[model samples]
Target: MPQYKLIYFKTTGVSEFVRYLFSYADQDFEDVRHDITTWSKFKPETPYGVLPILEIDGKTYHQSLAIGRYLAKEFNLTGSNTLEDLEIDSMVDTINDYRILFSQYLWETNEDTRAKQKEQLVQEKIPFYLTRFENRVKANGGYFFGAKLTWADLFFVSLKPYVDFTIGFDTLKNHVALAEHAKKINAIPNIKKWLDTRPTECCIQEFLDAKHKD
Candidate 1:
């Protein structure tokens, strides 16, 4: 096996799904997390100056979804065929789209603007995507794609904490299928173990709290 190392911020952020992929496959990796101070010095050396980067052997690569897709294929969490792969990729990308939107709200500096974004996110965007995601899980019998677990499922489940914190409540409260899907993913032995042992402080929450206090 090639030596693997994952480099990211102290927060789960986009890297959490990649960690889930590693856990689900029972693969060992060096999870290197950096705080803002450390990240500043290291940023110049990174491929894109952004994480989460995966170092395979000694070669470094950037982009979270690309790394995730590569690992999913390696771990047999990917689709069985090209068409199935397309479906899984589509779902994963869609989930990422909403994540980007939520991140906008989380990072917004203007209080009034942030409040407006939150209102739109809570009232319009969250429901629009989650309701469809719920139906997709229902159609696939609780999985995100096809008849089996895929990286798409891991990707969505890994974002649960971040999503909940961004919305300031359970984002899946009305989306029963999505909630159940998350439950099933969390119940996986390796995944459950990782969740139980991983650091609990999501830096996104700290960022939001700090902003509120300003």
Candidate 2:
């Protein structure tokens, strides 16, 4: 067995799914959570000054999705074939796009600008993605690819809490399939255990709260 160490911010952002992957595989790894104060010291040691690095037997790997894909393949969370893998990768990329968009609202300092962006994201972008995701779930019989669970499902469900907090509403309310899909993933034994054990507060929510307080 390879030694594994995952280093990321305390926030879920990109590392959460990798953590989920580990949990799903019932693998033991050192989860190192860093914060802003410590990141500067840690940054120079990492490639590209970016994080969610995975150290496997002392060699470092960067990029969250790349690490995720490797782990997915290793753990059989990846789809069975190439086409299915492509589709799953596409969906994961789509969710990453959504996360990036939501970060704009989370970081924007101007109230009016932030409000406008938030409205557009909620009223237009989110629904568009949610509907598409819902349809995919419906098509796949509750999972993202086939009958079994895939990393795409884990990726989606792992990022959901931050997305919901940033949207400030129940974005899945109108999407029954998506809601049920989330429920199904949440009920998975490993995922449920992780959810119950992890930190309740999300990073973006904490950032927003602190910004308001300031």
Candidate 3:
């Protein structure tokens, strides 16, 4: 096995899906988390000065989704064929599109602007995307792609907490299929163990608060 070290901030943001992939695969990795103070010192050393980088046997690679795709393939969480792979990738990217909208609201400095973004996110964007996602999962018989669990399912489930926090409520409330899908993923033994034991700090929230104060 290659020596794997995952470098990211101290919160389960973009890095959480990769962490889930590791847990689901039962792969041991060095999860290196940084705070604002430490990140400043370490930023220059990264390949792109952005995080969620995975060091595989001392060769570091960047990009969260790319790393996820690689790991999913390695762990057999990917689709069986090219067409299935396309569907899985499409679903993951669609989820990412919605996640980016929430991120914009989270980091917005202007209160009025943030309020508007939040309204649009909560009232329009969230429902629009999640309704489609709910129907997708329902159509696929409780999974995102085919008859079995794929990385697309893991990706959505892993990001649920962050999305829920941004929405100030359970984003899955009206989406029954999505709620059940999350339950199914969380029920996995390894994934459950990881969730139960992972770090508890809301580092992203703290960082945003500090930023606004500054």
- Cα RMSD (Å) per model? 2.0, 2.3, 1.1
Candidate 3: segments with Cα more than 4 A from true spot: none
Q: Write the per-residue lDDT of candidate 3 for residues 139-212, one digit (tens) a residue.
A: 89899888699999899999988888876889988887789899999999999999999988767876787798
Residue 25 displacement in candidate 1 (angstroms): 0.4
Q: Rank the candidates by lDDT, best first.
A: 3, 1, 2
TM-score computed on alpha carbons, candidate 3: 0.97
The 0-to-1 C-alpha lDDT of every candidate, in the order given, reads: 0.88, 0.85, 0.90
The worst-scoring run of ten residues by lDDT in candidate 1 lies at: 201-210
Tell me the TM-score of each prediction against the true structure: 0.94, 0.91, 0.97
Task: Write model 1 residue lDDT over 1-214, tens digit each, in one string.
Answer: 9899999877777789999999998999999988756777999999778888899999999999999999999999888899989989999999999899988888888889989999999889999999889888898878988768999999999998877877789998888778888999999999999999987654565545666777
Question: Over 4 Å off in model 2, which ranges?
Answer: 201-214
**For model 2, what is the error of residue 188's alpha carbon versus the real structure, in angstroms, after optimal superposition?**
1.1
Which pairs clash (backbone N, Cα, C closer than 3 Å) in model 3? none
**Sequence-dependent TM-score of model 1:** 0.94
